[model samples]
Target chain A: MNTPTPAHVDGNAAAGVLREVFAVDLTAAVGQCDNCGCAVVLAEARLYTRAPGMVGRCPGCQAILFRVVRGPDRTWLDLRGLRCIEVSLPDS
Target chain B: MGIVSPGFSGRRRTADLPPGQYLTDDFPVLSAGPTPRVRPEEWSFTITTETGREHRWTWREFRALPTERPTVDLHCVTRWSKLGTHWEGVSLDTLLAGVETTADHALAHSYGGYTTNMPLADLRDGKAWIAFRFDGEALAPEHGGPARLLVPHLYLWKSAKWVRGITLLTHDRPGFWESAGYHDYGDPWREQRYWGD
Candidate 1:
C-alpha cells in the first residue's frame, strides 16, 4: 500500500477514534479496471457510485464499472463492460 | 457497474458482501465516506476563521439549520461505488451565508488530519453542508452522525465525515487519504483515484 502524502493546504484535521485507516490487513489487490484493463490497487485508489445500475467511470477510461445487484438469495456483480470476472479466491 | 442503491435493499446486500466497502455506481453515493460517531449532546460543530473568530452550535441547533432531504448518488475512490441515498441537513451555502467566511477560507477538515480544499464557489449555491440525517431518520454513527460535511462533487472523501469544526485557511490542504496518495481532486469519472497520475 502506498503511503498517501498530505497535500498540506491550510487548517488542521483532527484525529478520530480510529488510529489507523484500517486495522484489517488487506490482501494484495487484484482489482482490474474493467475499462483499459488497468490493475486497481486498493491501497492507492478508491471507488464510488455515480449512477444507478451504471457504475461510473473506471477512472482509467472514464468507463462505467460493474456493480452487484440483488440475486434470488444473494447479490451478484452485474458486469457491464464484459462477462463475469474470475475471482482468484473462492466464492464467499 | 459499481453502482448500488443504498436507498434499496440491494445496497444492503452489497454493503454486507464486501471488504467493508460501499457498493454503488454513483461516485458520490458509494463514496459518501465513512460515517462519524454520533454524539447527541456532546457533539458540537464550530466554524473558525484564521482571524480567530468562531461560531459554535450543538446537535439540537444544527439539526434545525434548514434541513433538506435529497436522494443523490455517491462515488468512491477505490473504483465504482455508487448509491442513491437521501440526506437531510443545512445546505453548505445557507450555513456559510449565515456565518462569516472572511476573506480567508477553510479547507474541508476532518478527523486524523484529514483536510481537503474547498473554494468559496464550491460551498455556495447549496453544493455542500454538514449532514446530520439520512432519509427521514437520524444519521448513523458510521454515516457521520452528529454531523458530517457533504460535498457531492470531487468524490465523497472531500466531504469530510465526523467533522468536528471548520477552520479557515489561507491555502488548500489535503486530507488523510489525499496525503497518503489519493488524488487531490478525486473524480471517479476521471478516475483520479490516487495522487499524481
Candidate 2:
C-alpha cells in the first residue's frame, strides 16, 4: 500500500475529524481564504497532518484556512482564518 | 460507514493517555509538504526578530551549543499519542541566552516553506529545544533532521520540522497553521485545540 505524503493531502482528508465536531460531513463546505482572498471548497484546501493537529491551507495562496485540533476532553475547530465557511445542509 | 483496517485495532485505552488520544507504539510521519533534504555542511540556523536583528549559526556552530536529552510524550491532533520519546538537542534557553528581544512570539520557518508560531515564552526556560538527534542517532530528514524545534508543552505541530530560522515578533502573528484554523496557543493537556474552544 502506498502511504500518502503528509503534506500533499486535501480537505477531504479532514472529513473524519470534522464530522466528530460538526455532525455532518464538512468536506463539501465552501470557504474563502482570509489571507489571499481565494475561494474554494473545503475539500480542496491543502492539508497537513504531520503536526499535533490537522491544518488546511488555501490551495491558491497557501494560506492556512482552517485547523482542527482534537484533545481528550474536547475538540477545537478554528475557522476564523477563513473569511467565510458555507455549508449546504441537506433538504429536510 | 467507516472502513476499518485489518491491523489497526491494536490500540487500547491507557491511564496515561490524554483525553481523546489513543496509545500508539508507532511514530507516525505527518507533514504539510515534501520532506526536506539538507546537508549538515550547508545548513544553518538563523534567529531574527521584527526589528531586523538576526543571529546566524551554521550546523557546526549550532551543535556547539549546550545540548540535552529529554523524554516526553507526543500528542498528535489526529488522536494518536506516543509517550517516552527521547530526543537530544540544544535548549532554546541556551540559544536565546545572550540574544535580547522584547518579542512576545516566534515564527519558526523551515526549509520547505513551512512555518508555525508560538509565544516566545513557550520556547524558553527549558520549554523547547532544537532537536538534532532522536533515539540516540542523527535525526532523519523524513522526521525533520539536521534539527527541528521541539515544543513538548504544546501539540507536536508547534514543533516545526526542518526548522531553519526563528522570527521573533513583538506581537503574536499567525504562522502557517494559526492563520489557517488551528488554535493560536495549542496546549493539548488543556484541550486548547481550536479557536473559540
Candidate 3:
C-alpha cells in the first residue's frame, strides 16, 4: 500500500508564537531532544500548528521538541521534550 | 467583563465562547507531522479489547454500516472553538455494537502513528463517531480524510485524525500528546490543556 509522506514546515513557522513568550528570537536557539539527544536550532525543528497549538518535533527523532498553546490571558509553553536549549547571549 | 475599548468593533460575538477560548469561523488544520493519505481500499478499522480479542472492518464494510449526520461544536485545546460544524459518520456505538469489552479506557491510533487517549465512556452514547464527511464533502486529507475520530465533547485533539483503530485498555495509557505533557483528559471547558491545567 502506498502511504503518502506527511509534510511540515520548520520551527521558523512558530517564531511568531514563540515571540509572544520570549523577548529574544528563539528560532536560532539550539535545543537537544530529550529522546534522541540530537541538538538542532529551533528553526530546524519540525513545526506543526494544525491543532490548537504549535507542536515542534525533533527532526532527528521525530519526538516532540516543544508545544506552545496561547490563550486570551495566558500562553502555555511546554518544553519537556527538550533536555536543554542553548540561546546565544549578547556580549557586554 | 472588561470595558469595551473606544471605537472597538468586535470581529464576532463572544457570548458563547468557553473560558479562555476565541470563536473562529475557519477550521484550522493542525497535525503533529505530515498528513497520511491512506487509500480507502487499503484502509481498515480495528478494535482490540484488553481481553486480546480483535474486531475488524474494511472500508467497504465500514461505509455500509449505519451512518449519521451530526452537527456539533469543536473546541481545541489551543483555545479556538468552532461552533456548528457538520459531519457524517458511523457512531462509535454502532461500531462497537455486539463487541464485548470490559475496558473503560480507549487509545485511538491514527494512520501516521498519532494517538490520543480518553475514557471509553466518552466514545459511547452518541458522543463520538468515525467521521468521514465534513460539511457534505468527503473529509480532506489535511483535515483527517478517509475518516477521523470525532469526539466533540472533549478538545479536538482527542478526535484523532486519520484514525485507524482503537485499543480498549483496562487502564489508561497516555498517547503521543499525553506523554508529551498535554492533559490526559482534555476538557476545553476546564481549560485542561496542560498536565496541571
Candidate 4:
C-alpha cells in the first residue's frame, strides 16, 4: 500500500513491553513531559516501534517521553524524557 | 549447540537464526512516523563530508549507476530475522569512490526526519547498498522506496529507511534510536538491543 507517510500508534500499543517492567498497566499512568511540561496519560502519547525498542513521545512537543527495550533476560526502561509519572493505585 | 531431544519437534531449525531472533517469512513494515511518498523524480541521494564537500545523484543518475542484486539475510534488533531477501541497488563503495572523507563514522539522514549512525567502514567494501528494488519489484514506500540504505550485517534499523543522504562525521554520533537508549552499534548476534547491552 502507498501510504503517504508513516504513522504511529498510541502508547496503548506499548503495554505488552511496559508490562514486563511495571506491575500495573502503565498506559493509564499520567506522565508529564520534561521538555514541554505537557501532562497526559501514557496511552495518549505517541508510540513509535520502528526501532529496536518502543518509544513513547509526548503528544505536545514530540519529545521522547519514555523508551522500553526488551532483551532475552532483562528489560531496559528509560523515562528521562518525562518529569514525572503519576500512577493511580487502588485503595487497599 | 546441544543435541535434539527425542520427540521434540521445534517450530523451525534454530541453526540459521541469530541469538535471540526468530525467523519471519513475511517482511514486516515498521516506521517511526508517516511514510514519506517521495517520487522518483524528486528523489536524490547525497553524501556530505565533514569538510563540506557534497556529492549528489538525482534519481535518474542514481538509476544509471551500476547496480548489483544481493541476496542477504536481515537481522533486526527487534528479534526478527528474514533470510534470503533479494535486493537491487548501488553499493556504497561505488558511491563513495571519488568522495573524500577523513571521517570514521557516518550519520544517515532520511526524508522523514529519521536518522541512524554507523561506522564508515561498515558502508564500504561491499558491505552496504542503497537498495531501490526488492524481490525483483520496485521497493514499496512502506519498505523505504524510492531507495533505502541496506546494511544487512547489522541490525535492520541501521539500514535507515527513507534514507536520503549521509553526513560523514569525524566522531560517532548517536541517531534517533541510539539517543533513546538503544545500543549505538546494534548487533543482533551480540544481543545489543539496549544501551548497556
Candidate 5:
C-alpha cells in the first residue's frame, strides 16, 4: 500500500533531535495551546521541519506550542505558547 | 561504496538558486496541524494595529479587491527550492492602501491558529500577498485555501498558510517559530535558519 504525502507529522518525528536537549521523552508529555486552550499530548501536535528547526503546532488549532533549535554550541527552546507542560517522572 | 540511483545526477544549477539549497519540482506540504476546512462564505480577512483599530473584509469583499499574478521562486529553510512557482493574490500594499500606521511589525494569524511575525516593511511594495490561487487553480485546502500569506523573500514558514489576519505592532514581538528557537528573521539568502546561524 502507498502512503499519502504528509504535509506534516507529529512531534514524535522530532524525538531524535529533541533527545539532545531533553533527558526525558518530550513527545509523551502533555502540552496546552495558548490560542484555543486545547490540552493534548506533544505527540499529537503537528511537526514541521521544512525550516531550520523543529516546530510543534497544536493539533486542535495549529498554534505553535514549542520550538527547538540546535546551534553549534547550544540548544535553544521556546515554549511560550504552552500554558503548561506535564511530564511524567521516571521510576527511581 | 554507496549506491547511486539509475538517473543520479549532481545538484542542478541555476542563477536564482540560493546557497545550500537543492531544486525540486514537488511542492511539499508542511503544516503544523490538520488542514482547516474553511467555507467560502464564512471566511474573512482582518488587519488590526497596535492601537486596537481593525479593518475587516469578507471572502467576497476580499476577492473584489485587485490582485496580482506573480511567478516567483520559493525557498524552504530545510533546503528545498521550488523555482518558477505561480501565484495569484491581492498584494498587501493594496490591502494596506490609505491605511495609516506607525507600526514596525505585523503578526500573521491563520484560520487554524497558526501565526508568524514579520516586519511591516516585508509586506509592502509588492513584497507579499494573501494568495488564493496557485498554478492557475484555487489553492487546495491542504495548501491553505481561502488564502495564505505569500512572503517569497523569506523562508516558507514566514509564509503562514490559511492566513486570516494581520496584527500590526509598534514593537517587535516574535511569533510562533520566532519565539521558538528559529531565527526571528528567516532570510534564505543569508542562511539564517536557526537561532544563530
Candidate 6:
C-alpha cells in the first residue's frame, strides 16, 4: 500500500514552518465495523504527510479506528485509528 | 512518565514526543495549522507574574478589558513562522499594574506546564497580552480559545495555548514544547524549533 506525502508550502516566516502541508482528498469507502460487525459506508480516508491522516471512525463505536487505503486490486485496511499506542488504561 | 512540570530541570525532548503529535486541518488554514470549528464557550484565562501571584479571568472580563494591538512574529514548533501578527488584548504592562512583581522575580506561565522567564525590563516594555482574538477575529480553540498568553518577542509556543492562568514565580518554568524536546526559546531567525542543534 502506498501513501502520498503532503507537499510543503513555501511562504514568509509569518506563514509558519513544518512547511509540509498535506493535500487531502476525501475518498469514501465501505467498512465492516470490528465491534458490531455492522457495514458502514461513506467512510472517509485522508493521506497525510506523516501517515494516513484519518480513516474510518465508528459512528457506533467511537473506540474503533482504522487506516484504509487501496492496495493493488483490493482495499487495504490497517484497522487502527491513532498512531499512538503507548497510552494505556489503568488495569483493574 | 514523571510528575510533569514546566521548566523542570532535566526536561524531556520532542525527539521523545510520543507519537501522533502532528497538526490538524480543521479550519480553513486560517493563517496556518488546523483549528477546531466548534467554538468552546466555557473556558478560563489566567494571569501569572514572577511574584508567585495567580489570577483567573472569565470571558466577560477578558473581553471587557481594554483592547490593544501587539505586532508579533509567531514561530511554530512545526517550523512555520508568521510575522507582524497584530493581536488585540490587554498589554502585559497594563496587566502588571493589576499585580506587583519585583524586577528580580518574573515568569510567564502557560497550559501544559509551560513557563518562560521574563526580565522586569521586558515586562515593562508593554508588548505582551492574554490574547483572545487573532486576525481581527475571535480566537479559535485550536489557536488557543478563550484566552492565551502571547509573548511576541520569543517563539509562538511561548504564547501558550489553552491558557488557563498565569503564575508569577521567582524562577522560570519551561513550557510543554520546551520540556518535550522543543527549543525552550523558539526563535524563527535562529531556526530553533526542536531540541539539539
Q: TM-score of A-chain in each prediction?
A: 0.35, 0.70, 0.73, 0.73, 0.70, 0.31
- Give the lowest summed-lDDT range of ten residues in model 3 chain A: A68-77
Error of 1 at B11 (Å): 13
Q: List the residue pairs that clash in candidate 4.
A: A5-B34, A5-B35, A6-B33, A6-B34, A6-B35
* lDDT score for residue A29 of model 1: 33
Q: Which ten residues in a row have the lowest lDDT in candidate 4 chain B?
A: B5-14
For model 2, residues B1-197, the per-residue Cα lDDT tens digits are 88997558753446777777788888889877557899999899999977888899999999888899999888876678888889999999998987888999899999978888999999988889999999999999988998999998888888998999999998888876666557889888887666665
TM-scores across all candidates? Answer: 0.55, 0.68, 0.74, 0.76, 0.77, 0.49
Segments in model 4 whose C-alpha atoms lie over 4 Å from true places: A1-40, A58-65, A72-92, B1-13
Per-residue CA lDDT of candidate 5, range B21-120, in tens? 8888899887656678998799999999788888999999999999999988899876889988899999999999957789999999998777888999
Model 5 ranges off by over 4 Å: A1-22, A26-66, A70-74, A79-91, B1-12
Q: Write the per-residue lDDT of candidate 4 for residues B14-91, one digit (tens) a residue.
A: 587889898888998887766799999999999999998999999999999999999999987777889889999999
* Model 6, CA-based lDDT: 0.51
* Runs off by more than 4 Å, candidate 2: A1-92, B1-13
Candidate 4, backbone clash total: 5
Clash count for candidate 3 is 5
| TM-score, prediction 3 | 0.74
On the 0 to 100 scale, the lDDT of residue A8 in model 2 is 71
Candidate 2 lDDT, A1-92, residue by residue in tens: 99877877778988876675487677898888998887779888888876656878888887677777665566667787698777776773
Task: Give the residue spans of candidate 1 off by over 4 A.
Answer: A1-92, B1-36, B102-105, B111-113
DockQ of each: 0.07, 0.23, 0.27, 0.32, 0.29, 0.02
The candidate 1 chain B region of ten consecutive residues with least summed lDDT is B26-35
lDDT of 1 by residue, A5-89 (tens): 9788443353331323223332233456655887644333334433222232344554434443322243334445432233343
- Give the CAPRI class of candidate 6: incorrect
Clashes of each: 64, 10, 5, 5, 1, 26
Taking the tens digit of each residue's C-alpha lDDT, what string does model 6 give over A1-92? 87777576345753432222212221333555565655555333222322112233556644344544332234444543433222212342
